[model samples]
Structures are given as C-alpha cells and as structure tokens.
Target: MSPVLPPALRGLPVAPVISHPVGQQTTVQPTTACELPQQSATGWLKEDSIASGVLIVLVLTGVQRLIGFVRSLLFCRWLEPDQLGQWDVAWGFLMLAAPLTVLSLPGTFGRYLEHYRAAGQLRVFLCRTAVVCLGLALVASGILLVMPEAFSWLIFGSGAQQQLIGPLAGTLLAVIAYNYLISLLTSLRTMRLVAVLETVNSAGFALAGGLLIYCWQRSAASAIVAYGSASLLCVVAATGWMQAIWQQAPQICPAIPQREFWAKLLPFAGWIMLVNLLTNLFMIADRYLVAQFAPGDSEARLALVGQYHSARVLPLLLASLASMLAAMILPHLSRDWEAGSRQQVSRRMNLGLKLLGLSLTAASAVLLLVAPLLFGLAFAGKYQQGLDILPWTLLSGVWFGAAALAQMYLWCAERAAKACLATALGLAVSVVLNLLLLPRMGLQGVVLAAA
Candidate 1:
C-alpha cells in the first residue's frame, strides 16, 4: 500500500537507483575510459633517429679529417710553393663555375630527392631530378664556354694562360658532378656512403696530384688535371653504387628530370642557390683577388695562397662536419614543424646549436695551436704566411657553424624569403669587402675578405 502505479507502467522494468554517500539517490551512468593521444613514443623514436644521424656524421667528419691530413702531407712534400698557389687559383675558378651552373641545383635535387625517397616516391623524383641535373650541367658548361673569358678575366685577368684553361674546365665539370652525388648521398641519410665517396675521392686526388708532382715533375696545371680525373672517378663510382641498388628491380618512366623535380623546391632553391654563390665568393674570392691584383706577384701570392689554403684546411673540415650534421637534422626539424611539435623543434634546435658550438670550439682550438707547425710540416716552407690569418679564418668556421643552424631553422620555418635576403645581403657585403680589401692587404686582405 506504499505506492500505486499504472498497470502498463508496472510491466516495464525499473531503472536501477544507486545511493550516494551523501544520502542522495543517483542513477548509474556507465562510463567508457577516455583514451588520449600518445606522442611520447613517436617523439623518442624521432630523437633516436636524429642522434643516430649525428653520430654517423661525426664519424664521417673524422674520416674526412684523416684523409685530408694525409692529402695535405702529400701536397706539402710534393708540390712547390708556386705550383700550390696556382692550384689554389684553379680551384677558385672551379668554385665560381659551380654556383652559376644550375645554381647548385644538383644539391637541391639531392635534398628534395631525399624527402621524396623518405615519402616512398624516390624513383619518380630521382628520375625527374637526374634529367634536370644532366640538362643543367650541359647548359652551365655551355654558358661557361661562351663566357670563359669573363670569369677567367675576373679571376686571372688577361694573363690566364691557354694551358690552364683546359685543365680548369675539366676540373670544374668533374667537381660539379661530384658535388651533386655527394650531396645526394647526404640527403639520403647514407652518411657511411658519403664518407666512403669522400674518402675515395680525396685519396684519388691525393694520389693523382702526388704522382703528377713527384713522377711527372708536373706544373700546377697537372695538379688540376689530377683533381679533375679523381673527381670523375668518384662520380662514376658513386653512380655505380647507386645503380647496383636498382639492379634488383628497375622501372622506366617519363623523362621529366630535375626541371620537374625542382619545381617543388623553387622557393627555397632560389635563395639557397644565391646563398651558395655568395658563399663561394667568400671562400674563393680571396684566391681570385690575389690572382687579379698580384698577377705579376706570383711568387708572393703563391706562398700566401699555399698558407691560406693550409690554415683553411681545419676550418673546411669542421665546416663539413657541421654541414653534415645540419643536413641530417633538417629533415627531422621539417617533420616536427609540420606536425606542430613545438617542443620537439625547440629541443632539436638547442641540440644543434650545442653540437655546432662544441665541434667548432674544439676544432678552432686545435687549429690555432697546431696550425703553424702543421703548415710548416705539410707544405713548402713558404706557406708560413697562412699562419698569419689562422685566428681570423677560425672566425669564419664558427660563423659557418652558426649559419648552418640558422639556415636549418629558416628551412623548417619555410622562411626562404628571409633566408635568401639575409644570405644575399651577406654575400653582397663580402663581395664589396673583397674588392676593397684584397688589393691593399694582399693575403691578409684575402683573409679579411673571407671573414
């Protein structure tokens, strides 16, 4: 008699009522457990991948240094002061040709191909890029042919002798191709392969150049030829290695080459190309300036060039290490940025800066301490002038390390415009300084120009 209910309602099952601790009735509501997204595992995996890449790059750096040191010893023992200076000039010309020729698109191709390969579209991208690189190489070579005198005049002036031209052009062609392959391997994150190629190429050059100097009693021109031959061999070897991988299964596609492949990277490529050009100017302008101003002063310039080259050895080695590290981290940063992973980006960036600083600092200290003795031991005794510029040139090394970090950030941020503008501005400044300084200061001026 407690409560009365309708007949139809009484047939329906009653909902369960639960009593709370507060003495209130409550209805039970079944709740499913909430699942939050987990990124820690993926983040850790990404970090491990980056660390692995860094380690590989460091190992490669060590390999490069060992090879380079050996080559330096050979150069010191075999070549005369004047010949080494001429050799430096020849390399300068080759560097100039590099940027104007496809604006270093081969490198861009490598970078882009790496990305596409990571995305599982390597064949399509690689095919397209290959065409572009080949075509561009041809076009660049053609342009050089027409304007041969232009660069020669700028670098060597009217005195650029006929004998050097062939060697120079040949060296440039091989260097351009070799650069592309090395860059491509780096992009693929195959540091060991890159290191192997570099080691092989360095050994080839060292042996060939040494032979030319020792056996043939050759001039600087012969050294140029040796370098060219070595570069060609390295390019061939790298290509063969790459092709071997394709032998398992091969497919054919449209002949769209680098032109099509580069389309995706036009924005960054443009700036990067310009930046590279400027960089070349900074590195090579000193040699060119010395050649231009000190045309009749070959003896003095030769000694100076030999020394500057020696002092630069350690810096270049460290720069390679920095560059390799930067290359590997770029992809990781790009990925993190795309995924809206701010924390990861910050962490990666910090790590990059630390690594760069540490490497550069250690390298600079060693270079500063041992450079004079090393220079004395490695080259003709005349190369002592390079010691004069070591401290300042070390600055360039640190700058490059920092710049590499900045560049990676720009790449990740997609700030190509800013990057290009900054690089262009820096290049312009360096060029202006080179013209102003080198004529007055000689090799010291060249060092200043480099800085």
Candidate 2:
C-alpha cells in the first residue's frame, strides 16, 4: 500500500524498503560512494590550524630577520667598510653563481614535493630530488672550475677578485648541494627544522666571521671558510634530523616510479633555473653596475649600495615567512581543489591575505620608524648618510611581500611562466631604472632601482 518511490530514490527505495518490514531493514541499505575519515584536533579542513600555522611561520620569519640584523650590525662594528665591500662584491658574484649551479630547480622543489607527499610518496621523492641536486651541483662545480677567470673578470674585474676564484669555485659545489638538501626537508613540511637550520647557519656565520676577524686576523679567507663550513654542517644536521623524524613518524608511502627521477625532475628544474637566474640577476646586478659605473671610489659606491640594499633585508625576511606560509598551505589548497572544496579554498585565501597583510604592515611600520637609528647602529655612521634609502625601501617591502605571495600562488597554480614573466618585467624595470639613474644619483640611484 506504500506510494511508489520517485526516480531519485528508486535505486534504494528506502521508504518502501522500510515499510515492507522491520526485519527487512537489515537486508538493504543505501550505497555511499565514500566515507570521510574521522576529524582530529588538527583536521585538514580546519581554519584554526591554518591560522596557527600562519602565526607560527610569521613569528619564525621575524626571528630569522632579527638574527640577520644583529649579525650585520656585529659585522659592521668589527670590519671596515672597504673590507666589507670587497667581501660583498665577492659574495654578490658567488650569489649569482648559485642559481646557475642548481639550474634553479630547487626553488620549485617544494611545490612538487608537496604533491608527492599528498599522493603518499615521500621517501621516493626525497631520494630522487637528492640525486638530481647532486648531479647538477657536480656539473656546475666542474664548469665553474674550468671557467674561473671568465667569472672572476665578469664580476670583480681583472683585479683582486681574480684571487677569490679558487676559494669561490672550490666551495661552490658544496654550497649548492647543501642548499638543495636543506630545501628538500623544507618541502617535506618540516618548517620548524628549516627555520632552525637557517638560524644555525646564520648564527654560525656570524660567530665564524667574528672569530675570523677579531680572533683570526680579519681574513676574508677565514670568513668564507667558516661560512661554507657552517652551511655544510647545517645541511648535514638537518638531513639527518629529517630522516630520524621520518623513521619515527612515517607520514607518507614510498612512491618512486620505476623510471629514473632525473628525467622527471629535469623539465621542472629548467623552469626553476630560469626563474632563479632572472630573479638573482635583478637583485645583484645593481651592485655590479654600481661597481662598474661609479666614477670614484668604487668600493665606497659599492658599500653605499650595500647599505641601502641591506635595509630591505629585514622586510625580505618577513616576506619569506609569508612565502613559507603560502607554500605550506599550497598542497592543502591543491588537495582541497581536487576534492571540490571551493568554500574552504576561498576561506583559506582570505585568511592568508589578512594574516600576511597585518604582519607585513606592522613590520614595515617599525622599520620605517627606526630606519635612521638602526642604519646608524648597523653601519657605524659611515653609511648613515644614505638613510634616505630606508623609507622608500621600507615602503617597497609591501610590494616585495605581495610579489612573493603572488609568486607562491603562481607556483601552486603551476603558472611558472606567468611568474617568470612578472619577475622578468620587474627585473627589466629595475635594470633600466638603474642604468638611467645610477650616474645621476650614484648609490641613491641603486636604491631607487631596488625600490
């Protein structure tokens, strides 16, 4: 006597089945496509976890910047401007070489590693990435060793920088390898460990630099030795720690494919290479240009440029934290999008913006307010004359942080081409501006270009 079931319910016919008999209830049931796992305190979908993660990332980023600031101040007090300038020029060239060595692939490693982790294949991901990094490092090192003079003359002219060629080339491979390995752990979502490694590296560099200067006679060789050795040590410590954590708390399954990992990593690595090269080129080219075009006291001009550029460091550190937060949330965003969680994704985007905005605004304000005082303290009043760079540079932090966030979004969205385009444009603008402005404004021109 029960009414006929509608088409929508015809498959299960729950009403009719229930009306038939109580005993029949056990005989039939509606089919469910899937079941959700039990939610936990840190469930994947929760906003609270996202907020906490953002807060933690930002705080750690602040810590990293503070460490850098203190270290720079100490270095300035201990070393003369000309001495620091020489080190800076050598270091700038070294920074330029770094991206080339890795083919810039490690920059995007975190994104792919996130995908692998989400797919439950972590160990295979790490091993494969390591192989790619090592191979690239060795190749880059060999090339640098072969073409040492070409690099030396290009960055440091035919003068004293030629002397740095051996030391620079010798440690170049290890530095690149160490960086790639440290970055691998970061991709695995061990952010705390990543921050710790950076802190240790920074602290170690400062301590080593101090020891070399005051205790060991202000040798740039000693400073470089300490810096490279500390980087290698941190990489080793972090790698071992990551392996131990993996063993203790296995998070994902081994999913390395039968095909070699190098093949899979090459295309992505190439993209990373272009992105990093263009980005680093934009960052360091101005100093090189200053060294090239400044009419008198190239060292003084370079040091002035260094002072202005250093002002941006604190903001960059904070922005990096924002980038880290974005990176952490990206895999979750990708997973949610796949799972059709549109609402959750929107919420995450809004929350990420809000948190990042507040943190950046506050930091920028403090830097702007104390820029003169801080610059004076850090540079020992020698470069305090260029304090005007602080305000423009601090304001530029907003753009830097936003740009970084945008890059992260692009990276997660697999819009590397668009990210590259944006960066290329920014770099072009910077280069053109510097070329036009540096002769007129000298160090201030470089600051304008950087801004």
State each model's CA lDDT, in order: 0.61, 0.59
Tell me how candidate 2 scores on lDDT. Answer: 0.59
Work out candidate 1's RMSD over C-alphas. 18.7
Q: Let me know the TM-score candidate 1 reaches against the reference structure.
A: 0.71
> Model 1: per-residue lDDT, tens digit, 40-76?
2222112234467667657756776777777767775
Residue-by-residue lDDT tens digits, candidate 2, 238-326 = 65565553443334444455565556656655655565566666666777777666656646655664565455555655655555655
Q: TM per model?
A: 0.71, 0.70
Runs of candidate 2 exceeding 4 Å displacement: 1-60, 105-132, 142-149, 217-222, 238-261, 313-368, 406-414
lDDT of candidate 1?
A: 0.61
